[model samples]
Target: VQGSFKADIKLEDFVNNSAAVVQTINTWVEDRTNNLIQNLLSQNDVTRDTRLIIINCIYFKGTWRKQFEERSTNENADFHEASGNVSKVKLMFTKEKYLYGENKDLRVQIAHLPYKSDNTHVQFVFTVILPEKGVSLDSVEQKLSSKPQLLQQILNDGYTRTEELLLYLPKFKMEASFELSDVLKKLGMVNAFSDSAADFTGIVSKKDDPAGLYVSKVIHKAFIDVNEKGSEAAATTAIRLTKRRRLASDIKLVEFKVDRPFIFMIRESHNNITFFSGKFLSVPLSYYKRALRKIDVIFLDELGSEAAAATAVIMATKSISFRPKPSPIEFKADRPFLFYIRETRQNLTLFTGKFLTPTNFS
Candidate 1:
């Protein structure tokens, strides 16, 4: 989704004021999304001096331009990926000159539309699958013979056609966040965020001798819903910056596979960067459905017995790990704590419920 806008503001000045940052974000969203989306959170929440700022938002609105008509959509269309499994998906067939592009190897069409406002932008990328089935990702590199040409074609080529058919797609929503550090680091952008990263010297006036500080956290959320009626989705990204002259370190992606039921905590020491992580429990899904989920406590007394077990386990685990020794001894049997829990086809009360006193359980 995207909208149209024209303005130029200094990045440093925008970073200093929370309101400015939010307004800029809103503008970016509107422009990028082509006005298909809107900013829900007020601008004051995101500020320069603030160590951590939360950007909570949702996009329940519909699309400004419907690319695929209901009559031309094909229901039960098989979306066969590189894998052997075939997923029944709605086939939106359009010969329209979307942001169309192609080369000797690949044909990628990008559909640009408004998101309702100017805070973010999204492009619908339609890539033609060269290989019919059994996709080999390793071979994909060889397939894109001319990426530049393909990009150019998508930007300036193609035709438009509409028809009558059925389209059926499952609704989906995802909430996620990224530490700006990780994003920058991924882009080979460590130099701009390091201790000696002189590029940021202009962020403040002289005389304010800065010490050790780096980006502390990132938070994000995305939602998508589709049913017999239609489909709508949106995502929000937030960054938390800390003031310190810190060095960029190697990113160690610890793969905590939640194959079995286990409890973990997110605190200052564990380096747990994610929050509110979770998995979906389809009928066949076991603990193996997803890798890990970040947990937080809510409604302790009313959480019943399950919440108590998760709390105890998290308390016991956090106390022994980080620097200065977090005092898990303070964790009471009644109060709730935070920890990831694995669900199953059967009952998943692996380590919870015993802590509740006898004859007093709810």
Candidate 2:
């Protein structure tokens, strides 16, 4: 059985070190990763303890508003980096009001869209450098560094409100978990995680006793989605610990420049339904649609599932077979048939009556 969720501290040193205590923890957890999870658990805290150890973990997910169909991504595309190297990357494209710019001299159009905010708060910006008749990204970043706003000037004046844009991005998602004890030690605060280290006066100090300020578990999870129209990223980082007491503080910002292909997903926390799904597999739409039709909607993975459907009906989850041999008309067009869809965690009502009357399905 899953236990109740709570943040309990010894409460003795909770007042003094509250400020630094929270800041240190935030830095420790946030510095571990540079991804999209930060956007999810932006304003969060991890509590410490003496006897009971609290472990907090979160799952973050997201997807693009306007999907870049799988087949749109093709090979023979150039991906330029800050190091003056161009890799062969599969570019995904779409025509929309995207963040775009064109460097006439370099002959490239770069569109940048920040990814969704998650726990680790990472922004995935992509620049599609459409090289001119003979230009390439190889000389672009270098020229920008020398001239500074060469790219900026283009971005400022080159931003056009075009509805249809040829967009190309690789879909991807990253999952990582790290235990940050030694990492914290490297960040300059050493006494906090030791047995003989003195003075936790800021957080809970019991008569000069050094039994406080030992971090047990620092778990951070992140997720991000970026495609056509804008991007979304989110995450939840929990510091489940013991021998401690501290108050939480402000959050920091981190950016992840995504210039390659990656996979991503959008998961519903409350209902666990994946409303919109995107893959960077470069497969046909019909393949995914047909596969999706056979898979259970409630719990779908990259593979498949034998998930069970709901039984009790009180809303829109009804089947022609679920009725009966001339079932009683407890719910007519005046009332309506009510069934439940476990996947979306919603109570849907199928009705054919007055809007006013259909709403009173108590």
Candidate 3:
């Protein structure tokens, strides 16, 4: 609680000046999140019955160790969805050395991309878990849910090797908001949400006054942007006590193309803590079918047979010689996938999301 701050707002003022109070809270959220999130709470969110409001915000900005070249990003790359739909997306490409692993048992390919950190003791990484082409992301999620240790194994035991790879990842931005009272209730924390059963003697002494306290609503909002440079993410959570609610590789390397839907996470390398995790399912209404470029073929109809034959021979001789290069192993994630952001030393997940679609495209 060293960095924690507390403030008291009169209930009368909160109810009378609801808009101002909401603006004050939103201003704090915007400041904490570098303006990435705004209007976190509205008039309907706060009420006179609300005894207390607690909020937490986290913001992160990290640059890639070896960034993707802006010019190398393909503006119209094809992303294949799980439903067999295709969308045009901004795809990033790079060939560099990176920590990588493959788990046959899990049927997944893992790649670790480290971020540049000023603190030597702190190392942040973006990890992508791409299921084998035929494997469904749901299956992988089910397996990880069933045996959480498998995720640890995937992070610790599986990624010991480094390889050069051709990587393709999409540039995406996502903003998500969730009302988590029901989710928390389902997790078996019912008493806190129950007005009759909730005990708030610790927060509000019964001797002082006894309407008691229960969580009314729990809302969480998050935002993230991943591009050629690195990533910027912000998240905020507000708990109203009025209710018992909660609220890249190089030459000859393997190819790791995230052209499909997959799983991704950002973590601190030292403590193996996951900060954010989510799946990129699909790119909303941003689907585009690239129009085939029309090529005009001119025939030498006016040329004599002998002349045409001679021209054909000359053209054949002058044709550019194409050599077949060795194809690196391709790890294209053309479908949906997941991503996470975390702090290393404390082993805390900062952000988790899925980039199903591109929010911005040129």
Top-lDDT structure, candidate number: 3
- Please list the Cα RMSD from the true structure of every candidate, rounded to 1 decimal place: 23.2, 23.9, 19.9
Q: Identify the leading candidate in terms of TM-score.
A: 3
Question: How does each model score on lDDT?
Answer: 0.24, 0.29, 0.60
Weakest lDDT window of 10 consecutive positions for candidate 2: 353-362
Error of 2 at 268 (Å): 19
| TM-score of structure candidate 1 | 0.36
- If scored against the real structure, what TM-score would every candidate get? 0.36, 0.34, 0.79
Candidates ranked by lDDT: 3, 2, 1
Identify the superior model by TM-score, candidate 1 or candidate 2: 1
Instruction: Please give the RMSD of candidate 1 to the true structure.
Output: 23.2
Q: Identify the superior model by lDDT, candidate 1 or candidate 3.
A: 3
Q: Residues 243-265, candidate 2, lDDT per residue (tens digit)?
A: 11122332222112123221122
Q: Deviation in angstroms for 79 in model 2? A: 7.0
Candidate 3 residue spans exceeding 4 A from truth: 1-12, 235-253, 286-329
TM-score of 3: 0.79
